[model samples]
Target: MIVLGVESSCDETGLALYDTQHGLLSHALYSQVAMHEEYGGVVPELASRDHIRRAIPLLQQALADAKLAPQDIDAIAYTQGPGLAGALLVGSSVACSLGLALDKPVLGIHHLEGHLLSPLLAKEPPEFPFIALLVSGGHTQLMRVDGVGQYTLLGETLDDAAGEAFDKSAKLLGLGYPGGPAISRLAEFGDPLAYKLPRPMLHSKDFNFSFSGLKTAVLTVVKNHEEKVIANICEQDKANIARGFVDAIVDVLTAKCVNALKHTGLKRLVIAGGVGANSQLRASLNEAAAKKRFKVYYPELEFCTDNGAMIAFAGAMRLQINPDAAQRDYSFNVRPRWPLDEIKVV
Candidate 1:
C-alpha cells in the first residue's frame, strides 16, 4: 500500500509517501525554525500560517519525487492532534480533501505516535514489546509498547518536558532558540563536574520525572554568579554550566530508563522525539544500554525531529495491521490534546 502522510504539528511542514512494499518512497519537509529563531521560540500564529503556505507545495514535491500520480496513492494520513490547532488543521484539511477527491482512505494519526513509531523506519527496527522514551519540546514520557496501538504510559514530566528544559536552560545561558543543540555543542568544551546541579526526582521509585527544580538550580547559579562577579561569566564558565546542566538531565533520563526496563523487564528500548537528537542523551543511553546488554533503537538523525515519513510509516503500519481502521470519510478534525493510550487501531 502507498500511504501519503502530512505533518504540521508545530513549526515544520512535512509530506511523504510511504510504500509498504518499497519502504519510504518519497519524503519532503520545510522548517520554520529560521523564521522563529529571532523570537527565541515558536510563534504559534506564524507557525500555523507557514504550514498553510508550505503543505501543498511540499505534497506536490513529495508526489513528484515518488514519481507517482494522485491515483497511485492508496491512502492519506495526517497528524490530527496534540499540537498547535491551526498547524494541525492545515495538514488535516489538505489530506482529507485530497482523500475525498481521490476517494481514498484517510487516517488521523497522533503526532506522538509518529515519533513513537519512527524507529521502525530504520534498516533493522525493534520489534514490539519495547520501552519507548519520548522526549520532545512539548512532552516527556516513557511508555511500554506491546503492539501497534498497545501503549502503557509509564511516566511523564511533572512540569517542563526535557526538550523545553533544554531550550529554557539554553536561553538562561544566552544560547539561541532551540537551545538543546546549542547547549549540547557547548557542553563538549565544558567540565561536567565544574558545577553540580540537582537531578530532581531521579530516585523516585515511580517512573515520573521533574525538571522544574533543575531549571531553578540553573537560575540560582546564574544569579549568584552575576551578583558576585559583577559581570557576565567567561566562556569557560558558560560551557561548564552547560555541561553540568546536560549531565544532570542525562543522568535523570538514563536512570529512569534503566528503572523502567527493570520494572517492566523489557530489554528493548526505542528513543523518540526531537530531544532524541541530542548527542549526549543518545550517547549516554547507548553506552548504558550496551553495558546492560539491552538493545536500543533510534530513528536516523534527519528523522529525529518531526517529519512526514514517520507519520506515513505509522499510518501504513496501522493500516496493514487492520485495514478496516482506515477512514474513508472526508470530515476532519484537529486534536489539540489527545491521549496516546486512547488510540485504537481499528
Candidate 2:
C-alpha cells in the first residue's frame, strides 16, 4: 500500500509517500527554524501559516521524487494531535481534504507514535519488545514497547524535559532560540573537567527523570559567575557551562537507561525524538551499550526530527498490522493534547 504522510506538528512542514512494498519513496521537509529564530522561538500563528503554504508544494515534491501521481496513493495519514493546535489543524485538514478528493482512507496518527517508530525505518532496525526512550520537544519518556501500539510507560520527567532543559540552559548562556544544537556545538570546545554540575535524581531508585533542577543549577552557575566577575560570562566559561550541563544530562540519561534495561531485562534500546540526535548522548549511550553488551538503535539523521517520513512510515505500519485501523470518514478533528498510552489497539 502507498500511504502519504503529512506532518505539521510544529515548525516543520513535511510531506512524504511511503510504499509498504518499497519502503519510503520520498520525503520533502521545510523547517521554519530560520524564520522563527528571528523571534527567538516558534510563533504558533506563523507556523500554522507556513504549513499552509508549504504543504502542497512539498506534496508535489514528494510525488515527483517518488515518480507517482496523487491517484497512486492508497491512503492519507497525518499527525493529529499532541502539538500546536493550529499547526496540527493545517496538516489534518490537508490530509483529510486529500483523502476526500482521492476517495481514500485517512488515519489520525499520534505525533509521538511517529517519533516512537521512526527508528524502524533504519537499515538496521531493532526487533519487537524493546525499550524506547522518547525525548522530543516537550517530552522525555521511557517506555517498554512490546510491539506496535503496545507501550507501557516506565517513567517520564517530573518537570522540564531534556530538550527543554537544553534550550533553557542555552538561553541562560545567552544562546539563540532552539538552543539544544547551539549548546551542544559549543560543548565541543569545552574542557570536561573545568566545572562540575549536579546530576539531579541521577541515583533515584525509579526510572523517573528530573531536569528542572539541573536547569536551575545552570542558572545558578551563570548568575554566580556574572555576579563575581562583574561582566558577562566569557566564551570559555559558556563552553565550560555547556559541557558541564551536557555531561550531567548525559550521565543521568545513560544511568537511567542502563537501569531500565536491567530492570526490564531487555537488551535492545531504541532512542527516538529530536534529542536523540544529540552527539553527546549518542556517544554516551554507544559506550554504555558496548560495555553493557546490548543493542541501541536510532533513526537516520534526516528522520531524527519532526518529519513526514516517520509519520508516513508509522501510518503504513499501523495499516499493515490492522487494515481497519483507517476509516472512510473525511470529517476529522485534531487533538493537541493526546497521550501515547491512550492509543488502543486498532
Residue 178 of model 2: what lDDT?
92
lDDT of 2 by residue, 103-169 (tens): 9999999999999999999999999999999999799999999988999999999999999999989
Cα lDDT, all candidates:
0.92, 0.93
The candidate that wins on TM-score is: 2
Specify the poorest-scoring 10-residue window by lDDT in model 2. Answer: 225-234
Clashes of each: 0, 1
Off by over 4 Å in 2: 226-231
Candidate 1 lDDT over 1-346, as tens digits, reads 9999999999999999999999999999999989999999999999999998898899889999999999999999899988998889888999999998999999999999999999999999999999999997889999999988889999999999999899999998888897999999999999978999999998888999899889888888998895444146788999999999999999999999998998999999999999998999999999999899899899998898999999999899999989876778889888999988788844
Candidate 2 is scored at a TM of 0.98
